[model samples]
Target chain A: MERVPVLKIGDILLVSIQIDMEDQTALQLQEDLADRIVETGCHGVIIDISALDIVDSFVGRTLATIASISRVLDAETVVVGMRPAVAITLVELGLSLPGIRTALNVELGMALLARERDFEFKDIDDDEDDADEAVVAAS
Target chain B: MALSTDEVGRFAGLLESNGDALTTAWTDAVATLLRGRLSHAELHRQIAELQKGFQSALAGGAGDLEADAAGELRGLLSELSNTRARQGFSATETAVSIFALKEAMLTVLGQDGDINATTLRDYVSFSAFVDRAGLFTFDSYVRAREELISDQAEQLLELSTPVVKLWEGVVAVPLVGTLDSARAQVVMERLLQTLVDTGSPYAIIDITGVPAVDTQVAQHILKTVVAARLMGADCIISGIRPQIAQTIVALGIEFGDIATKASLADALRHVLRKADVNAGRRGAGRRES
Candidate 1:
């Protein structure tokens, strides 16, 4: 089975799936990704599926599994570069792909992961909380 | 009943000899019906063209408009009706104008003073042919009107769903009027496509102009938000009126985790600050207080 490659940039690992991931290949990729996260001690994982055409229920479940696995391994998973058509198809199928963080592109994914880190570190704590609450309540 | 070959020949011969008088009578009757909306000269020219079409078709022995020899006549009839349709003439007026030709031929034929049963029978057949032509004009007028309506509907669909840039990483879609399924689909596709094109992280859907918040409209909005979320963009729905809010609560519609705002400005500010937090921009510095 062909393996999906995992590249590390800074503290984030990028997984750009360029092939049609068979069930076995996807399982193997999950295993490989978990191993890399442990080996590099990275805090963020970004999955780029912009080139992917069809994302059925099987793909949705697989992505959710990947996200859960990353969370359990102490890393944030952000799926980036999803095509609009695929997103619409997934929604029409009623699969919201729970447990996955998404970004418009790889750049935004990195920023999201960075922000996630900031939220953890507790530096801008009180102000961020206040603004977040105001956004929810003032509207 | 279809006109006989010799009857068609008589029509052609009458048009050749008394064409000027027939066209003038036809134009006068039609002009009176139209109430002078069209210029006298333009009306004269159109009547002349119509007469020429009939003259040529009869000369070719076209007993029926459907016959191959009357191809030019069919083309001219459709073209006249189409232009008149666009120019806002009623279908009845156009059909009646064609019917005026029958009366014009009757008056001209009477001037010949050759009154006989055979001539009256021939006139009856000619009147039948003109009635068919008038009905044909009505059909083409209706067809042209329907085409114009559909074209405008498509244009309106395109115009109504515009996704505009709100900030560097934010976009907005201001929706107006009724939120039908078709328009909802258009809004969703355009919003998502703009999200991809500009890589906007946040989108604000302003529905202030939306007259009501029915279950279906809310469903459309929720589906759009969910779809955009799948593509890694946040959608904030803004511009909810007080009445709509009460209706939404009454309906027990769950917006889930999607954020809603009371106005477009609030939504914009909300997204901008969130974007600042993500990009680590100075927009976050205001929080130092």
Candidate 2:
């Protein structure tokens, strides 16, 4: 099984998915990401899927799972670099992936993560609406 | 109608012998019907080209217009109709030119001598052949007209949805006309793609030129905004007129947390202020306001 590398950038963990992930690969990545967040105590995780072309429901569910897993572990999850075609497909497929923040690219994804950190600093329990507003502003 | 090889040979000889006279008669007949819509020289040139195509086809022993020998003639006729269709000539005018040759042929055939029974039989077949040609001309004209219309529609689609950058990290799509499903899909795709390309985290969909907002139009716009959000870009819908606003409330269509403004400028200011606030420059912009 191919493995997706997870790199640590400062206070955040960046996972650039450059391969078409098999079911096993995605599950493994989720497990590995959870392990790394606990080990490094990172507060944010950015999943970059810009290299992906066809994002089926399986991938969509995996992304949602990753977001939730990271959230439960006290790390904010931002899914960035979603292609226009992929977004349209996901929308048509009715998989909006709620609660997962998105940015146009990895750079903006980092900025969004930074802002989310700022929000966390200001408020211990962040407001859901406020988080979405930060997404709009940071994006 | 089908022409026998022998009769086809005789007709080809007749066309070649009286080439100039046949073209003159055909052109004059068509010019009168068209009321001088076409230049005489262009009409003459087209007539001459068709004549040459016909003579060559018959010389090549074409028993009917559908024969392989008539390929050049079909090509010439298609070209004539294509040009005439684009030049705004009616289908009838275009087909009439082909039918006019029947009169020119009959006049030429009668000038030779007394009309024999076999010659009359041949004239009937030849007249039928001209009818077939006339139908072919009409078909080509209609085909060309349909192509022109479809091409124009495609060009209009391209012209209608242009995603342009309004400022740094901001883009806008000024929409006009009714929003159909196909157009909505296009606008959505282009806006999202532009957001990805320019990394413009903010977008403004200005509908100032849009005449009205129906439920379907509102649905399309909402879908676009949602799709943009998925791509990590925020879309602000701008240019809601008073009547459109009333209609939105009447329809109970909720924009739901998406920012909207009265004008393009307002939307721009909103985006700039949000951007400034996010970039940690909120104090200065808020103080100015």
Candidate 3:
């Protein structure tokens, strides 16, 4: 099966991967997605794994690796739409995806990204305003 | 050969009567074969040669009585050696298991190398002995040790304090002990669940019994407060010992939005006053209704 599917939504890129993910194809897909994320300069990356039935050790490790790589590329990666069974299985196996953000669905993840972007732009505007006031005061 | 019934009966009686004599003769013959009258080196060489001859004769086939006997002796010796090796391994494993169990018992009782009948019975019951052999397997010993440790930890945790309701919407938990990550997590869950169950709006965690606090424990406490706030509860921390405060300052941890009080009583008073204000507001609303 095609392990990863990359789709661009507005300025955000959505990367959807399949279940039972433990093969060379999965690794290659992750690498390809990471490269694409870096190249496109997308605002955010949504890792959709809604089709996964079980999240085993290998798949959990791979997802965590991808999340880390995405961070280095300056793109926030949010894992979205995990099934309850998959979550329970991961907990039972003592597998944790530390340093990775998770959301219940893609909509919430996208909304969260938008909010963060808004906050960043607001900080930039505030800084610009402060710089302008400082210049005026010096004059 | 062929024999009548009367002849067969007579032969059986004769064999029974001569059994002791036959056994003695057999023993003598074996002793003679095993006797060492020559020099030690010569005897060793003879035994080595005999072993080699027996090996070769067995490899050839058991075609004669002497060769068959030699092969049987070699087989019997090998079997005995294997049995002895297995017995030795079993004995060593048993000894190690017993030692581990003893250590586990001592740890549980908070003693060293003291064993009594009651303790032994408790250990056996906790270990679930299968039979009267008084043998507990290594796996069972390890499991029992873990259980004993967990039980002791749980007892220590329970002795710290139960969640006390100070006001209608506030509860307090006094935490003690060196909060390792595991114990910190347990405290977090217990406090959160109590808040949820009591529908309290505020929780005060007094860290009086905490001997030392590290970054991990601090982070755990922060996480718990954050989670509780997410569930619409305010967490107040009190009883910050000087050492813990020094450590926290040294580590440069940010408390930020969490409320801190000097003592549990102060924290409870703060929460109760807030609850009273809310209650007054509710009473005014009822009067207006």
List of clashing residue pairs for candidate 3? none
Question: Distance (Å) between predicted and true CA of A133, model 2?
Answer: 28
**lDDT by residue for model 1 (B179-277), tens:** 999889989999999999999989999999999999999999999999999988999999999999999999999998889999999999889877766
DockQ of each: 0.46, 0.47, 0.03
The residue-by-residue lDDT of candidate 3 on A1-139, one tens digit each, is 5556677766577877664565786798778877777766665778777777777778778878987888788788787766544554465466657766775567756765655555556435434321111111100
Q: Write the per-residue lDDT of candidate 2 for residues B120-178, one digit (tens) a residue.
A: 98888888888887899899999999999989978988999999999999999999888
- Please state the error at residue B223 of candidate 1 in Å: 1.7
Better of 1 and 3 by lDDT: 1
Residue B124 local lDDT, model 3: 48
Model 1, residue pairs in steric clash = none
Identify the runs in model 2 with alpha carbons over 4 angstroms from their true place: A123-139, B110-117, B246-252, B281-289
Q: Give the TM-score of candidate 1.
A: 0.85
- Count steric clashes of candidate 2: 0
Candidate 3: lDDT of B97? 22
Q: Candidate 2 at residue B45, lDDT?
A: 90
